[model samples]
Target chain A: MLWEMSASHIEESQDVTSQDLDEKLDLLSLQCLFLMNQVISMKVDIERRMKEGTGMLAKARYVMGGSSVSTLQIPSEEAGMTASTLSSFEESERMIGKSLRLKYYNFRVFPSAKVKDDTEDEVKDGIEQKLSNLQLDPRQSQASNPLRWFGVLVPNSLREAQKIFGGVLLLCAECSSIESELEAVIREIDILNQVKSNRQQK
Target chain B: MSDFPSSARPGKLLAIIGDEDTCVGFLLGGIGQLDKHRKSNFFVVDKSLYPSATNIEEIENAFQQFVKRDDVDIILINQHVAEVIRNVIDRHTSPIPAVLEIPSKDYPYDPSKDSILRRAKGMYTAEDFR
Candidate 1:
């Protein structure tokens, strides 16, 4: 009679555990759905922007061929063109849940010319290297014009292409963060699946 | 001493491995960079310019090289070009230096073939929720 009572209690606890796992799995799947939608929309946006940017680029190439832009062309090696990234990713973790989330941040444009000066200042302040101590003057930041690398007198088509692609680059950055989140949700679902299967087997 | 904000620079690069037009468009955006090693973060896989010149190995190599680079935080490849090296792209498991397969001038975006989307769909069906 005692064995029967203990068996009924164990069965009741098993049912509750499996029900909890099911609820968790459903929540994760819903998260996956949301993330999947976000990614697909971003992909569509990327496609449209890329098509427009490339079309403008092709037009620029054609215009260059018809004109004397060749004389103004800077050799790849000589241009020495380098751009400071305007975006970055920050990683944070939920220690209890054991899940990772990547956050994307877009920074203001800092011209390459100013980068050297900033490095020097940073070196001087090495004693107090805390990021909070550094006071960033907004007016000090300048608009980034990469077309200056080609020449001050670049074709209109080229300028338009640059503007279009710049937006696309930011979109790409945002998409990466969303995609990473989707990966995390999928991982959670997989773990729950293993737990559910293990329970069933036992 | 200018009271400039502590370096807003993220110091990370976005690498591209795409066709001619894709490379040109993005390069014009000011993401183009050439390091002291004379190595560029972006690689152009153009077969139209030099017909049949770009091979699978070259594409794979560029993708692998970009993945190995520590400074690159994001790698963007054209969807059509990514098809040539789908296996390599799928094999990459790192969440950092995220790999994003984007559309190109000639090809449109297809979500079904997207590596991440496919994995999500494969994991669970709508009926499973029911």
Candidate 2:
């Protein structure tokens, strides 16, 4: 009778240990998910702002072009040519400003790790090896090129869409790193939980 | 206007010592608008308001008042103006407000001619090994 009681107590202990481990894993997963969501939201905000800026630039250009049509009165042909050249120069300056702003957005969109072209492939390989060595289930890796993804997802406005998508791609890379770290901690807890369960069974 | 906490807010005074057009552009940008009846971003002290004929003394007084204020974050002076008040500007060691030399509208920015970069290069060369 006493032997049977001891065996039942051991079985109950094993169940409790496993439950605790599962709860801890769930908490870590939730924390990682929250961080990922924050990054995604920021990326979305940046995309919206970029779109608004582009719209403003387009409107400004249209207005400038329209205004010139009404003021075509010139005393001499040379004067008209000079006026046209000046307007063209002003238009070019505006275009250059827009281009510089776009470049800044592009620079901010990528993750620090993927900034260097030479090391991206090697870094990806390293991440895969680390996961496999730890015997952890690897999540699906996102495609290397953000432009390709933009082409398929947002086909109509390729230039603007690609810039926005690039921002999200960077956020995704950050999320992946955070997830990997959390995975390691959860795996260790799982291993400890398994050991406790085995001991209780005995 | 947003009310930033006193401690967090930038200094209340800004002095821009530059040519006429440069000062005008900054004024339009809302640098200093202190009125007894209204709120302002900064206390602008330009060449027109305080002429250079009085020598560096008048300019120094304005600089002193601006730098003494606890609320200012940035002090922008044109490169030419800075040349005249180089001594006074150099004497300022406080880190609360950074003093920046901006190019006037008519003048072009020359990286090679910047005083800060020149000083940095001098220090670097002095420490260089054979």
TM-score of each: 0.74, 0.33
All predictions: root-mean-square deviation over Cα? Answer: 10.7, 24.9
Chain B of candidate 2 achieves a TM-score of 0.68
By lDDT, the best candidate is 1
Please provide, for model 2 over B25-99, each residue's C-alpha lDDT reduced to its tens digit, 9 standing for 90 to 100.
233222333434333322334545454557567666666766775654345565556666778877874433445
- Best of the candidates, TM-score: 1
Cα lDDT, model 1, residue A138: 39
Q: Which residue pairs show backbone clashes in model 2?
A: B10-B71, B11-B71, B11-B72, B12-B71, B32-B42
Worst 10 residues of 1 chain B by lDDT: B1-10
